[model samples]
Target: MLKGRPLQYFGTCIALLNMLGMGWPSPFLPVLERDPLTSITKDEGSWIATTYLIAGPVGSIIAGIALNKIGRKRSLLLSALPFLTSWIIIAITQRLGFLLLARFIAGIGGGAIYSVLPIYISELVDPPIRGFLISVMGTLTIVASLFINILGYYVNITYSSLICTLPSVVFLLFFPFIPETPNYYIVNGKIDVARKVLSQVRGRQIDAEEIQELVESNEKGLAKAGVLDLFKIASNRKGLFVCLGTMGAQQLAGIVPIIFYTQTIFEKAAADFPVIASTSLLYVLLIVFSAVSSAIVDRLGRRPLLITSISCCCVALLMEGVNLYLKSQGGLNSIGLSWMTLGDLSFLVIGYSIGLLVLPSVFLSELFPLNVKGLAVGFCNIYFSVVAAAVSKLFQITSDHYGLHVPFFVFSASSFLSLVFAVIVVPETKNKSLEQIQIDLRNKDEHNKGEQTHLLKKYCSEQ
Candidate 1:
């Protein structure tokens, strides 16, 4: 089906692998802790998840720097090396230290790929189908989780790690065939090359107007930009704020912890239910709704989907908290309500997969101008890394001391706050060209500034 546009499929393959690597702990941690050979304590097992995130900021910074100097394609290609190395180490290592080192190395590659891949996809696809193409990454991520869960259940850690390395190897061998994005060429003073790339990707000769728009946008602000430049312009500032807020909402809502510890959560709530079966079913629901979100994102627009998605998360998480609280108090079994935990979690996955899981990265890739997109994405990804790590640790600590209900309540509160933020602040970038989005951001910023100035003048006159 993607033969007509192999770029879309190939470009996102590495993301599937990235998510698989990031989610490796979900199924493997419990197995590792139980194994006599590993001797992993609970605290040490927690770091198995956290260490991957701890190394993310370094990778984000490296990608941000390399994106301009080496081009997006080269930077992405470079990311595969760490993944390849990490999995190899995982396949052979029996020591806990090597496992952590391997996970940290994998995290570096994952961070770099996350920071750069979405931007690359956004630039390559047409605006009409951009949301669908980009949101496919979400679906692939769910697929990765599901795949790893099944694989880990059937195989030992060594075999699982060795199997995971195949995606990275495939990426290394195939991704080079795809051309660099026209935006990269345009910004780098290669207009003729940009035109050819644009033509090739679109499967036709590039029109003059499209080429002219690229030139004009490049002339306006697609020059080389540093991190500080992200704040100096009103549009860039707004874009950065939006991207950061989106990321904050996504991470703070507890997706990372839930993903990292899905089996643990299931085991805690419904010990009788088959953990692997339930987790696999949960991932299946996620894959289904993620595909639904991708199909309708362009038609429905981002704001509505996000508003609905976050609202569902809030309600589902609140229900889950109540269910866990009742279970902790020994009230659920007598009332025959043990099934509520699975049902409530299913609801939460439905909510998260539909919007919260998919849209933040889409916003990151869409909101910024070409000049500062790479740097802005890097910064947002670093913020993502920090929040994800903190949330993961917070979930573990709070659950240990205060019961799982406490962390669920906290996550529910964060989801409510994020819903408010989405309704009030997040802008719709659906069906808009990249250059047009930049212009709209500028115009919207100027309009707000004008209103503020007018109010200030009126206040002075009254005084």
Candidate 2:
């Protein structure tokens, strides 16, 4: 563990709490749909699940701007307001529209927290365990999400939602004790405060040399930043492409359908255990796998774990597609249930839990330059929110018109393609600094440019 880890972990819990609040509605959607208590239609039920995504991008954009203007801790503290207020809305509202509105509001907060958390954690921890702690953020979200899923599984909707809000309330209160990110302070011209923060977080005095290095990096970052800088700067442009691929793949990896349709799949297969129990089991594994991932990511490197996990995901989704296709055509036989179907899902859940779930946000935190970190995170969230919304809605439409196999096949194909993109585009950060990553990206681009120039000259001379 790094120095001042307990305080750092407290800050990271805010990220977990935010995501836990987001997960409350997933497992209980069944109750809201058919329990006769809420009694929402199929269509209305689907909308309730997706409205979070639609509003997420909006929250992320606001968080990005606020991250720069107000500072990370306060921006994060403010982000909790929407999620807490949202649970209150859920407890009070019986109207379907109001329910959707509440989810949307919470999604907004999630967007901000999701966008800002990686940045906050990255700055809080040193390089040795930076990836590990960032991965911890990922595991914590799974833990939080699964806890809410289990809570919502047993409890009534209003009480479950009210229970979920408590984390955010606790976060809002406890976070003031933690200081702002030194990177944020440095960037905002709070040099003395940045020094103190760095000392406090590291539990040792930051030497003049290290402080100077940080200040110089921020100066360079500020000089290069602008409205179109994300696209205009060569290093940032490459970072953007890589971030998009990783973030998009994570968001669109059919995870929503995997978790969202867990009960549906179990019901169709006539699984022995209740959907709640099976879902709980897989989610428990998700936490376990994520913890293992956090423990090992610093040593194993990001690319291998991602490639391996996603490869497993690709195969599992394909197997799932085949099984669904065969079952729909009556080519499959069942004795109360199909073990193969559940087995395929277990593989998929384990794969996603370990790599795809944890790494993309870590990549987002590490890959971008500090000046563009917030903007890059914001952009990825907005993009991911749109993709998430599409996949959520598409899962139903494709399942209805095209059959469940269609969406499964589509997801399988996306996973395979994303795996290839990751192999080629994503770099191994390992224990490298953000400045080091920028330099490496710049050099790689220059190498490519040199080859292109040579090829052009050779062709021109031949002509």
Candidate 3:
């Protein structure tokens, strides 16, 4: 019961930098490949697109080691530095080497933020609005992408990259004022301090007994666990698989390629709108739909929304493939379905924003306890970076070798698989307390314990 809800907005302000840096290169990538100012080959462009992802594991690894030691707020500040530095590099140098390194550096920073920020958000907010706050993160990301696209639309590459540094700077400056989450204090055994912070965030005094209950509940469950040990426990293992699946499905859904290659796709689709306008509209649709999805998440519950989302994604990808295939046949203008490609692109965002886009972050935030939170999230982001890099690099190669429709069709298949996985693996987390989530995870022995107790009582009675 946060009396002041601005805490969520503050979290979004800091986390927005990662996506801003991530989306900055999107609009400018097409220009970098063919513009006379900084003409690079397709191979170089692909490498540049992947360089950030390739470098992400470094940030995640470092964040895993230092996250708790340095604390969440400080760790987030460190993440901002790389984003700011990378944009500065981009602004100062157009040299291919410099640009590549900059993207990679930015990825390192983005990785740190991606790995740590969701955990921060999850711990900061309560369960009911947890989905909503996380949804705001995705919505802000779309908004940032739109902002960067607008910059690319109006300005030169150097100036636009320079302008990108501003938000990161603001985040770095403002984030330190925000307090660390209560979980961080609890994990450190500072129960009094944890209570104070929680009280502050809620803008009212929390009951000491409530904090004591939370500690007792999570003490054994959240004991100091390492990354590899995450698999040793049944509950932790299941949670790991869910996080991995969520990350894997997100990348395979082809969102990364869509961001990196939006201009290329628009050019090929012969889209009805200008490239800038179309990209802007895509972001707007994503933001609007993600906001709506967030609003409905708690009410509708997690599983149903996720099922509907991936189902729509499969259809969206299928239609996108068909649109590309038909357009390749060269009679789409006469048939007047060129608009269908745009519709598919729109639905891709709309569908994912509804479930796929934001829920994965929420999943990671809730799945692991404080002890393994950093490392577990790091592992997920590491996998995410690998998948992101592979998809982005292979997009051009696959499209060149097998045609654009093939990639879209492949993505469709992946989305369908993910839909099945969601049905089997994803539990409804909405409205459940974090402690309850852990209790549910460890409930497999309830019947066995009950039976044993009954057997013991009968034996004693016979005796």
TM-score list, all predictions? 0.95, 0.95, 0.91
Error of 2 at 423 (Å): 1.6
RMSD per model, one decimal: 2.1, 2.1, 4.0
Error of 2 at 313 (Å): 0.5
Which candidate gets the maximum lDDT versus the true structure?
1
Tens digit per residue, CA lDDT, model 3, 109-219: 878988888888777877878878776777877787788878886798889887888877777676666788888888888899999998877677789898998788778
Off by over 4 Å in 1: 1-22, 207-209
For model 1, name the residue pairs that clash. Answer: none
Q: For model 1, what is the alpha-carbon lDDT of residue 440? A: 94
Q: lDDT (CA) for every model shown?
A: 0.82, 0.82, 0.81
lDDT of 1 by residue, 1-463 (tens): 1322665555555444544544573667777778899888888988888888988998999998888778888888888888889888988985799989998998899789888888888888788888887888788878877887788888887898888888877777777777888888887888889898888777778887989877987676566677898899888888888888878888877977876777677667765767777777788999999999999999999999999999998998899888889888987872344468778888988999889888988898898877787788889889999999999999999999999899889989988999888988889998998878888988998899999999999999999
Model 3 TM-score (2 dp): 0.91
Ordered by TM-score, highest first, the candidates read 1, 2, 3
